[model samples]
Target: MNEPRSTYPFIARGASAELFDMGGGQALKLFRDSVSDEMIAREADASAHAAACGVPTAAATGQRIWDGRRGIIYPRLEGATLMDWISRNPMRAGWALDRMGEIHAVMHRVDGGTLRSLKQVLATDIAYGPAPDALQRAAIAYLETLPGGDALTHGDFHLGNVMMTPHGMMVIDWSKAAAGHPAADAVRSEMLMRFGIGPSDWVTNLWRDWAARRLRRSHAAASGVSTRDIDAWRPVVALAWLRARDATGRTPAFMRYLDGALKQAGLPFTG
Candidate 1:
């Protein structure tokens, strides 16, 4: 496909790509050259598969080449992300978190359909993560005993990845889409909310902790997955996160939380 004209206004930039407002009610997600074609292709396929399975996401309308970088076109979605909305309407955080939980449950209802396995993804991450050899082995062995499922999982699901539009909430960024147990995905979401890079002030940290609990409760209720099941997946997920987490965000509180999860799951500490 032809590169978008210089006139296409810039919209936003993320870790891997820059978005442009492609005229005609569409947006262009032009990925960086450093991003592999295979990764981009997986995201494109996963996005289409998700939409076909009735997941609320912007399906790729087309693919294009902008200069040397690859890009995908999608129907432009208008509105603030769930994160931004929550920031602006802190009083409604409960409602928003509840809605997010419900939406996540609904997404998990669909079959992953040819997507990569979430367990394998987690195992790979843990194998390559910073955990001690014994800890990694213990976590991977433990991971094997956990239940697996074909349910669709938005591997990177969180408030920031969800958009609150006029129609409703639309999930974006399928780069990390995978098939796995709903409980495992829920654990991942909990970790992201509590420890992912962001403001770490005491107030924000308290809110984050509360928001994670609220989201987990909502998801458990909607999905019929127990908190115990989610907890069972937590240690491995937390271990794998060490591979990709921002060092700046690895504060003392996060380390304590990680240790608690590991201890609860009977896994070795990272140190």
Candidate 2:
């Protein structure tokens, strides 16, 4: 395949992809060369699945290869992200969160079909993470004990991934979409809201805690999923996040949360 050489200025960039302006209100999500073809196909399939299931999301135009890079084209919706909306209307943060919960619930109702398993993903991350062998074994064992579900999980669902267009809200970024229990998905979302902020201080930590709690409560209420269900996945999600950070050699205060979660789950952690 010929390398994609375009003068179209990049409008945005993420961890693994760059959004290039495609004329006529469209954008190309060009991924890094490191991304595998399977990963690209998985994302494209998930995006289409979400749309077919009645979830609000941008439709993938088609998969393309340029310069050995892969990407999907999608319409460029005009609106602010949920985060930007909340920033512009701080007093309506609760409303924004509630909307987020509603969208998540809708997503979880969809059947996962041929999507990848969330449990398997967790197991893989645990195996590769810096956790001690004992902890890794215990985690994988605990994961086996959990019940399975066919719900379509937006593995990386968060306020930022939601966009508020004039037509309605549109979800983006299906890279982590998976087939699994909704509770696990909810837990992951809550964890990201709680600890994904960079370089946290006391005040920031307090604020994050407050926001995370509200977000969790809002999601639980809207989705009719119990707090217990979501909490059950907390340890697993925390370990995954810790492992990701470890992979990058960054030790953040959130490691304490992972330790606490493991203890709460009755897992022995020497590290």
Model 2 Cα lDDT, one tens digit per residue, 1-271: 2226877767877777888888899888889877877888888899999998899999787987755677898888788888778779889877777778878888988999999999898889988988888889999999889878889998877777889899888898888899999889988887777666443667766766676678777778777889778667878877876566431212455666677777878988544
Q: Residue 186 in model 1: shift from native, Å?
A: 0.7
True lDDT of residue 52, candidate 2: 86
TM values, all candidates: 0.95, 0.91
Q: Runs in model 2 with CA error above 4 Å?
A: 1-4, 197-199, 246-252
Backbone clashes counted, model 2: 1
Q: Which lDDT values do the candidates have, in the order given?
A: 0.87, 0.80
- Candidate 1's error at 202, in angstroms? 0.9
Supply candidate 1's per-residue lDDT for 210: 97
Where does the lowest 10-residue lDDT sum fall in candidate 1? 246-255
Model 1: pairs clashing at backbone N, Cα or C within 3 Å = none
lDDT of 1 by residue, 161-266 (tens): 9999999999899888899999888988998898787888778888899999999999999999997887888888878888888625546777787898999988
